[model samples]
Target: MKPLDTAILLAGVPLASPVTLLSGCVGFCEDLARMEGFDFSAVGAIFLKGTTLQARQGNRPPRVVETQGGMLNAIGLQNPGARHVVDHILPTIQHLPTRFFANIAGSTVAEYGEVARIFDDSPVDGIEINISCPNVKEGGAAFGSDPKVAAHVVETVKRVTSKPVITKLSPNVTDITRVAQAVIDAGTDAISAINTLMGMAIDLEKRRPVLGNGQGGLSGPAIKPVALLQVWRIHQIAGPRGIPIVGQGGITTARDAMEFMVAGATAIGLGTALFRNPLGAREVLDGMVAWGQRLGVANFHEIRGTLNQP
Candidate 1:
C-alpha cells in the first residue's frame, strides 16, 4: 500500500491532500477554492461541471433518480456557458492556492474544441473531457464508449490547448480499458475511470420514470466496490504506458482513499458525497493522512499498487 502524505502533487500543483472536489458549477468551484483557508487545502483539485459554448438549461425537473446501487442524474451539462466561465469564474481563483480543473461536454467535435480553447488561457491546471455522458440523440452510448469517437474527441481537444487533459470514462461499456487506451492514444494526459454507473428508478404511483430523464448516472457508496475494481484495472493499463490515474467513485472516507491507493490511484476525487456534506472532502483527507501516518506510510505514491507487485 502507498504511504500517506499531507499533500498530493497534480500536474505539478501542490495539493494539500489527494482529495479532489467534483462539481459542475462555476460559482461552487470558486467558493470551494476560497474555502481553502479553513483547511480546504487537502483538496487536490476541483473538477468543474460539464460545459458548452452556449448556455444550457439542463434537463427538466425530477432529473435525479435513486436506484439500488446509486443515484442517476440527467443534469445535461447545464451551465452559464464557456465565455461566462472564463469571464466570471477564472477571476475568483486567480490567486487561489490549488489547481483548477475544467470538465467539458459537447455534441460535436467543434463544440468540444471551442470550449477547450476558452479555458486554454485561464489559470486552470487541467481539463477533463466528459466523454462518458450518454448521447441524447446518437444511438450509440457516449463518445467514450466508442473508441473511434472517443479518440477523435481527445485529439480534437488536444489540438486547441496544451493544458493537461484528463479524459473521464464511463463504466457502462463492455471494455473500459479498450476505451481508455483509445483516448490515451490520442494524447490525454490522465484518465478518470468509471464516471457514474448507468441506472434508473421508477415512480410506482405515477407509473413513470422516477427521474424526468428516465435514466441517470449512478454514484455513491453503492458503486465503490465496482469503482475500486475499475481503478485497479485501469491502473494496470496505465502502468505500462506511464499514464497517471485519478481515482473516483463512491469515496466517503479516508479508508476509501487508501483502498484506491493500494489498488493504484495517483490521486482521488470525491463526488456525490460533497452534496451530502460540504466538509466531507476535508474530513476524508484528514482521516487518510492519519491512517497513513499510523501505517508508517510516508508517501501515497509508495502505496500505489504495492498490493499487486510480484
Candidate 2:
C-alpha cells in the first residue's frame, strides 16, 4: 500500500498536514510546545489567540462552564494586544516547526485593519479575521453577522496586508453562504466556517446567568451537526472559486474530521476537543492515515467534498 500523503496548500500556504490547531484552543503556540509528546511537525498550522489593536482585560470571571456534550465559553477574546504579540510573543515561538497564523479581532472595522497591518510585518504565515466571536459585546459577531459589513472588514484588511487573508464566518447568521460569498468577492483567500453558536446557561439556584457574560459561544460535540452543515453550505460557494475552507466546530475524533472533509473542509480545525485531549491531533492524523490506506487512496484530497445525496 502507498503511504498516505496528508499535506496540501491551504490558501496557497504549504502545510505538513490538514490538521490545524484552532485559535483560542492553543494559547500562542507556547503552551502546546511545552506539552509532552506533542509534535509540531505533525500538524499543519497554529492560529494564535485573537488579538486586538489595544490590550483588553476581557470579561469577568465564571467564563467557562461545562455542559452535556460540550462547554460554553465567554472568554471575550482576551489577549495582550497585537503590537505586544508581534514584538515580544512572536519571537519566542519562531522556532516552532509548523506555520503560525494570527487570529485577529477588533471593536471596529478600522481596528481590524490596524491589527492586520501590525501582523503583516510579523512572521505569521497568514491572518485569520475573527469577525465571529460571539462572546464579545462589540465588533465580533456584529461585523460578521452582516454581509456588507463583513465584506467591508475583509476589504479593509486586504488593503493593508500582503499576507493571505482568511475570513472566519459566524454560524449565528441566518444564511452563512451569503456572508461567505461576500467575503470571497471582497478578495479573501480562504474561509473558516462556523465559528461558534450563541448559547446561554442560567444559574438555576441564583436565577442569574451562569457565565459572566449573558451569552457565550457553544462548542464541542454538541455543535458538530450544525458545523458540518454550515461547512458544506459555505463550500458550495468557496469550492468553485478554488478557495479553501477551514472547517471547525466540534471535531473531536478522526471520524469527525473525515466527516468535515467529506462536507468540503480543505483543512480541519481541532478546537474544543484539544481542551479535553491535548494530544488529540496525533490520534486524529493517525486515524486519517489509516483510513486513507484502507481506502487505497494516496492523499486525502481525493475524498474531500465527495459526499453524495440520498
- Count of backbone clashes, every candidate in sequence: 8, 0
Candidate 2 segments whose C-alpha is farther than 4 A from its true place: 133-141
CA lDDT, every prediction? 0.79, 0.90
- Give a tens-digit lDDT track for model 2, residues 68-124: 899999998889999999999999888888999999998888889999999999999
C-alpha RMSD (angstroms) for model 2:
1.8
Error of 1 at 216 (Å): 0.6
lDDT of 1 by residue, 51-166 (tens): 88899999887877656645678887788898998898778765665667888888877788999999898878888899976555577468888888899999999999999898
Residue 138 CA displacement from its true place in model 2, Å: 9.0
Off by over 4 Å in 1: 1-4, 25-27, 30-38, 134-140
